[model samples]
Each structure stands twice: as structure tokens, then as C-alpha cells.
Target: MTAMSLGPAYSRLWTATALSNLGDGIRSAALPLLAASMSTDPVIVAGVAVAGQLPWLLLGLIAGALVDRFDQRRLVVLVDCGRTALLAALTVAVLTGSATVAWIYAIAFACGVGETLRDTATATLLPPLVNDADLERANGRLVNAEVAGNELIGPPVGGYLFGVAMVLPIAINGGTLALAAALIFSLPSVFAPAPTSESKGRIWSETMAGLRWLVRSRRMFTLSLLSGTFAFVDSMWFVVLVLFVQQILELPAAIYGLLVGIGAVGGLIGGFLAARIVRLLGPAPTLTTCLLAAAAGQLMLGLASEVVLAALGLAATSAAFGVWIVVARTQRQRSTPRDLLGRVTSASTTVVMTASPLGALVGGLIGREYGLRAAILLGVPALVIAACLAYAVLRERREPAP
Candidate 1:
């Protein structure tokens, strides 16, 4: 595929996503650590994590439906503004010595809600902004930006800022969101109005149509299943990794950041190469192989005792995850009609992400009872099971009719 030049409007959207993602990355790392600092209860800290993800499970579909009807660019701006205010409030509360675990949980839940809106709109808007032939490359660029923002820049900076003062990271995160909001406001309208007939339904009926369409599509159904499974297993690892690094390995916070940052480098590489890899391997087979490789990497993590070895395993796992996401996203964009894209993507995301909170709950229990190492090991089997499910359910499928 030839390189497709995006217009100013599309470029602005991409810039906003990249910038906001960086803030999101910082918050993802800092928020949990803040929760941990607030309470000695493992379950409470884990609950904070759950709060952040639970909105995606419950409100994702509704958010998607709204995205389908509303102006996506304006919706994005609204969500970003909401996030900015929420984070700013949290920062102020922390600075004034008024913060508690409950406060953190509330803030997290609010952020999650805003994120669900922003993400659903962003996913649906991409296809309309760029040419059809440029989908893979555009997706690759977005993925690359996300990895750079989330993995490389956000976590490490958050870690250091947390070390200095928890309020600093929160304040910076809010500022980032504010900047993203400003950028979003400048984005030109990317979504065309939905067809008149399609827009003339009750909200519930529209939502059900989206859900039905998604479930009826063989490719989408398989992809959603695979994503949900992957998220479940990954959430398990995420919940345990911090404890393992801090308690078992006895590493400093900065060192933990370094390890995570290094692993994210693999994600960066994977994102950069996603389009090329998809072309070379074909989308379905390449995605399936990546899932298996992710399982293998998790197995290696389960067996690793040394920090360097564990980091390597984490890097490999991240790489596989990154590639799989890009391929899956490209396929979804290619197969789904633009009009139904928002609701369908939201429906699929909600179903798949439902496993995340459950996984986090299980991971916390296992980590507290058996140990963090064992909890990490639990992800190995989950990953393998997910791989098997993908191969059996998705690999033989043909593209769904649009």
C-alpha cells in the first residue's frame, strides 16, 4: 500500500490521541501506586484497578451507541474536558491532604467513563478520516504512537514523579488531558451523519442492532473472543507484576519502571512493523501466531526467577500483544460498515473487556493467597487457552459481509 497523506483534521485527531494516551499511560501507573500508598489492603488496591476497567465492561456499548449518533469530534472534546477536570480535582484533593482510597476510586471510575467515550469514538472515526487502502498504515502509526506514549514515556515518568510527590503526576496528567482537549477542539468534523433510516430508532433497539450485527459476524465474534481472553490473562499479570517486583525481587520503584519501559520497547517495535508484518504473513495467520507466541512468552515469565529474564519475557509478550491488536483492529475496520462501526466496536469491546475486572479480582485473591509468582503463573494457562480458542474459532473463518 502506498503512503496516504492525512488531512489537517485527521492529523489533529491523531495528535490528540497520542498526547492523551501519554497522560493515560502516566495515570495508569501512578493511580495504582497511589492506591497502594493509601491502604495496606491488597484487595483495596486491586479494587482501584477494577474501578478503572469496570466502566469499559458496563458502559462501553452505550457509549458506542452515543458515538454513533453524536458528532464524534465534539464527543471526543467533551470526554477529554471531563477527564481533565477529574484529574485536576484528584490532584487538588491529594495536595490538600483530603484524599482517601474512596476518592481515588471515584476519580478512577470517572476517568474510566470518559476513556470509554473517547476510545469508542476514536476507534470508529479512524476509517472515515483516512483512505481505505491506508487503513493498515494508519492503524500502525496509531499503535506505534500509543506504545510510545503508554509504555515508553508514561510509566517511567509517572514512577519518578510518584517518587517525588504523588500530586505531581496527577497534576501533570490533568495538564496533558487539558492539552489534548485543546487539540481535539481544532479537529475538523470526521464523521458523516448516519443514514436517516438507521438513525430513527429507540436507543435500546439501536444498541441491540449493533450487538446483533457484531455477534453475527464470524470474524468479529472470533476477534472479540480472542481480545477478551487476552485482556483477562494480561490483567492477571498486571495485577501481580508490581507486587512481584517490589516484594519478591526487592526492586526499587525506579527499577520497576525501567523493566516495564524496556518491555514496552518491544511493543514499539511491534507497532512500527505491524503493517509490514500483516502484508507478509497475511492478517489471520499472523494474528493467530502472535497469540501463541504471547502464550509462550507468558510461560517463560512464569518460569523466570531473574529480573532480566522476566523483563525479556515481558518484552516478548508485549510485542506479540501489540502486533495482534494492530492486525485485529485493521481487520475490524476493513470488515465493518462505517455507519455501524461505532456501536459494533463498542459492543465487541464491552464483551471482551468484561473479563478484565474478573481477572483482576481473581489475580488479587491468588496473589494474596498463593503468592504473586503463582498468580503470574496463572496467566500462562489462560494465555494458552486463549490461543487454542482463537485457532479453533477464528482461523478458518471468512470475512463477514458488510
Candidate 2:
């Protein structure tokens, strides 16, 4: 398929992702607020955050193997359906006044499992749907859509809805999952079967092979490590941001949503412009530059005292990270073989995701011990380390002439 020919399918996929991600963003804010409303302990609220991501660390490999062995579209549909059902159940529990933190934790874990399945399948399915030449563009579009959904639409809506009724965000999240499932069902049947493997091997053996290849590739290894570090530091910011808004800046509850939404504007712009930037600077330079920009943004956030200044810094950081994500993901998608894509992506996701809970734990502890400002300032080093790693791993390279 030529790049132009792949446009329609890419559009369909991007739309579905954007819709689902909006729901994800709503849940991201709502869940924590729900926990906070129920309990005053920072540790417990952080635990809710940790539970949501725990599946990625534990079941990611298994999820990848399943994506490789089954129909990717069916897996996506099933996972989406499962999430919808789970969220609906939570909504019922909340409406009945029976919802507890434990219930939230269980639902969060289940949703995480579904997310793992959907993500692994999507990563594997994308390359085959688009032409090789269009992979970068497709990735950029998808990333941009995610930014719009998660950063732009979801957070602010979640805060407002939570103020009205806790069940509202959960219901909305459920509805979106159902819609996403319907979209997945409409995907072409070409993605039904896994690619042929030369050797018939057990799931464990195949999983090991995938992990080995990822670890053995110098560039892949470095990317995975940097990505994991990035996830950790970013998660720290996530945990502290709300507290910072409420406690330090003394901003209204609505500002949390507004600031996050504003920051998402950067992601939207980055996603839209990623392809052109890639063309101009080539992938390596683009990746390195964005990482450095993200580091600078994080540092600025740490230094800023005023809410507006902090939001600006965050917006810049988010935009830079958005572009960096597009560049790195495109490079990985272009470089990896189709058959190995699911496994490798899952492995990388597993590593990076593991860092999130750890970062949350550290952030919670640090915030409890010191202050939100201090906890946030600690993230600066992680960003710096990530930038340096990217620079070391991805040196300058010539761009292909159009």
C-alpha cells in the first residue's frame, strides 16, 4: 500500500484511539479523586494509581503472546468490551453507595489488563495496515489523537463530572469503551491471524526470544531503558500535580483539569507536526532535540512559583515529550520486523510501565515527607538522565531525500 492509499484506514484507527483515550483521561483523574474523597491517606490514593498500572508490569508479556497468537482485532474488541462491562459494574456500585477503594482497585486492575491486550494488538496491527513509508505519519497521527483525548478533552471533563456525580465519569468511560469495541469489530479481517513463525515454539519460548532480541539490540535496549526512566519521572509529576495545585498553588479544583488540558495543546501540535519535523531533522536528531526540550520543561516546572508559569512550563514539556514519543515510536516501528513487533513493544511497555508505580510510590513518599514542590523537583534528574541516554543512543543521521 502507498502512503496515500493507507490514509483512510489510518483515519479510522486514529479516530477510534482518540475516542477511547478521552475516556481513559477522564478515568485517570476521576479515579484518584474518588480515592481522595474516600480516604485522606496519600499512600492509599497512590495505591489506587499503582493498582491501575500493575497489570502492565505483570501480564504484559502474556498479553503480547496472546496478541501474536490470535486475531488482533478480536482481541481488541474483547478487551474493550471487558472494560466497558467492568466500568459499568463500578458505576452501579457507586450509585448504590457500595463502592469502596477496594472495589476501585479491582476495577482498575481489570481495566489495566484490557488496556494491555488492546495496546499490544494495536502496536502489531498498525504496520500492516499502513505502507512502510507511511508508518511515521500513521504513528504521528495516532499519538496526536491520544494527546487530544487524554490531555485535552478528558481531564477537564472528568473534574467537572466528578463534581456533579462520581458515577458520571464512570458511565462516560463505559460508554466510550463500548463505542471503541464497535469500531474494533468493524476492522478488516486481514488482521485475523498472526504472522507465520519459522519454528513452532511454546509461548514461553517465543516470549523469551522476543525479550532476548530486544535486550540484544543496543538501540532498542537504550530506548527501552530511557522510556522506562521517562515513565517513572512522568508518573511522579502526575502524582504530585494535583496536590501541588490544591496545596501549594492553592488553585481551584477546576484548574487541575484546565492546566492539564492546556498542556495537551502542545501534544496536539506536536502530533500534527511530527511528520514534517521528522522530515526536516531526521528521526535521531528530532528524538534527541525533543528529549532535551522535555528536560528543560521539567526543570522550569520545578523552578516556577506561579500557576501560570508552571502551566507554561508543563505545556512546553508536554509538547516536547509528545514530539519525542512520535519520533522514537516511529523509529521503533520502522526498525522492527512485523512478526516481532508485538512482543518487542510489549517488552518495552512492560519495562517502562513498571517504573510508573515505583515513581508514584516515591512521589507519594516524598510529598508526604517533604512537600509537593520538593517531590516535583526530584523529577528533573530523571528527565535529564533520559535526555542524555537518548543523545548517547541516537546520534545524528542523514535524512532520506523525498
Candidate 3:
């Protein structure tokens, strides 16, 4: 079926995901901005950023195994509920004047654990909700839910709300998670798949089943490597981005969200158009160009002096990111068997997730020692090298053997 035929279940799932994502975007922005208030030390500030991603590195493998073993829908609901509790506690902390960098770090890491499970489960949950032909289209809509909610609307609102009362946005973040859980609960019991008796015995073996496939697949492994490299570089660039914008570019704190928000327009557009682009360029060209975009966009932002150039550069980068994720996720789903989808998806994600914390640590140090300008410049060569390696891998795979 075409994307237009996506059923009620898929639509409901999408809505729930989008709602939570809106809240997630708010949490993602407000927390860092809040942490920034508690300390000027780039390491401390970047540490909170690291807390959010650290779980994916630590818990992603386990979560993927859990997703494959049990009901995905239930995991998502439980994770959302846990997030609600965490956000509520954070709101209380902020209102009570007890909010600390340590508190934020702990909460961020906990929430990230919830995210790692929910993300893998959600990806596994999706295929059952829609037809095979429309997976790409379905994924595109999901990306829009993420980009539009998280980056576009959420950040701008968060930037403004944090000024009114820091507690206000934190409270709202809890409420959204509650609502997302309620929506997810509306799904049928069939949403949870039963693991076959044979697959039940060993989590590690099940997990390894997916990893072995990834190691054996040139395309998936290469793509994962390329993505992992970029993930690392972007993490570093972003850790100090706010400081860069405020101090170096001299943009005021009030417009900070808008600065990131404008770039999200490219994400919104890319989400709408990724399938068309993939079809037009075909997977090889589409994947190759996405790498080029990553390198080029980072260079633009690093070299840009004025706010407008920076925004444009970011927009290009975000657009590329938007297309790249859709393409990667779509390729992943197409390649893996339905039974091992969770494990495979999680294993691949682990590679990308593993890099950001290191990047944050590095970015924090570089921005602290050299400057934010220098920190931003670091991504260019990394992405370029990744892009070149990816092109060679993709091209070489297509050539006829003797």
C-alpha cells in the first residue's frame, strides 16, 4: 500500500510519538539551558549533555535484547511513565530552588535510559503497524514528528518559557509524557509480539545474532561506521554551540532557540521529501550525497561569522541530517528480518549512540582551551573522511568481481 493507506493504528502511534517528541524536544533544550545557568565550566555543562547520551552507549544493547524478548508497546508506555516521574521531580527541584548540575545530570541519564528502550521498541513496533511498501514513508512521517516537534516548535517554546519560570517548562514536559503514555495505551494487545520458544533461551545469543549479521554485511557495517563518525563529530560541535553563539557570534540568549529552530526548517522539508530524494537518486547516490552534505554543512557553520550565515549553515546541516536518518533507518528496516529487527536496529544505533559522549568531552575541552570556533571546525575533516570512506565502500560493493 501507498503511504496514504497507513492505517489508524499507525496514525495513532505516530501522534503519540510526536507528542512525546515535542516534550522531549522541550526537555532536550530546557535542561541544557538550565544546566548552563548552574555552571560556566564547559566540562560541567557538557557533562549534562553527556548524561543524556551515555545510556545509549551503556544500555542500548541490553534494551535491544529486552525489546526482542518482550512486548514493545508495554515498554514504550512504561518508559514514558518513568519519564513523567523524572520530569515531575525535576520541576519540583527547579521550583524548590534545589536544582543543581548534579541533579540534572542524574535525571538526564535516567531519562536517556528510558529513551534507549523506547526508541528501539518503537522502531520494532512500527513495521507491524504499517505495510512493507510504506516503511520509508512511515519512517519519514516519524522523522517529521521528531524534527518538527523536537527541534522546530519545542525549542522555540522552551527558549521563551525558560525565561518566564524555569519550573514551568519542566512541569509541561511531565504532562506531555503522561499524555503520550495514555495515547499509546490505546493500541491493541497484538502490539506486543510473543517471542518464539526457540528464541527465548538466550538474550546474549539473540543479541549476537543481530551483531553477527551486521559484521557480515558490508553495507550496513560501513553505513554504521560512517554514521558513528559523524555522530561523534556533531556531539563535539554541539556541546559548545550555545557558548559559541552567545559569546563569539554575540547573539543574545533570547534568540538562541530561534537560531536552532530556523535550521529545523530544513529538517521539516527533508522529512517531507526524503523518500522522493531516495527514489530519485537511488540509495547509493542518496547515501553518498548525505555524507557530502554533512561535511559541507559543518564547514559552513564553522566558517560563518554572522548569525544569518550560521543559521543557513545549520539549516543545511539539519536538512542533511533529516534526509540521512530517514535513508539510514529505511535501509536498515529493509535489510533486516522482521524477527531480528529490534536487535539489528539497536546494534546499529549503538554505534551511532556510542560516539556523542566522547565528542562532548572532547568538544568541551577544545572549546574551553582553544575556542568554540575551533571546536566547530573539528567536524569538517571527520565527516569528509567518513564520506570518502562511505563512497568507496558503496562503489566498491557495486563493482563486478573477477
**TM-scores for all predictions:** 0.82, 0.82, 0.81
Q: How close to the true structure is residue 247 of candidate 1, measured as C-alpha lDDT? A: 83
Weakest ten-residue segment in model 1 by summed lDDT: 1-10
Off by over 4 Å in 1: 1-8, 29-48, 87-104, 162-167, 199-201, 237-258, 305-309, 361-402
* Number of backbone clashes in candidate 3: 0
In terms of lDDT, model 3 sits at 0.81
> What shift in Å separates residue 91 of candidate 1 from its native position after superposition?
5.4
How would you order the candidates by lDDT, starting with the best? Answer: 3, 1, 2
Cα lDDT of candidate 1 equals 0.80
Which pairs of residues clash in candidate 2, taking residues 3 or more apart in a chain or in different chains? none
Off by over 4 Å in 3: 1-5, 29-50, 85-107, 155-167, 188-190, 194-201, 239-258, 305-309, 363-378, 395-402
> Which run of 10 residues does model 3 get worst, by summed lDDT?
393-402
Task: Provide the overall lDDT of each model, using Cα atoms, as 2-decimal numbers.
Answer: 0.80, 0.79, 0.81
- By TM-score, how accurate is candidate 3? 0.81
RMSD of 1: 3.9
**Please, what's the RMSD in Å of model 3?**
4.3
Locate the minimum summed-lDDT window of 10 residues in model 2: 393-402
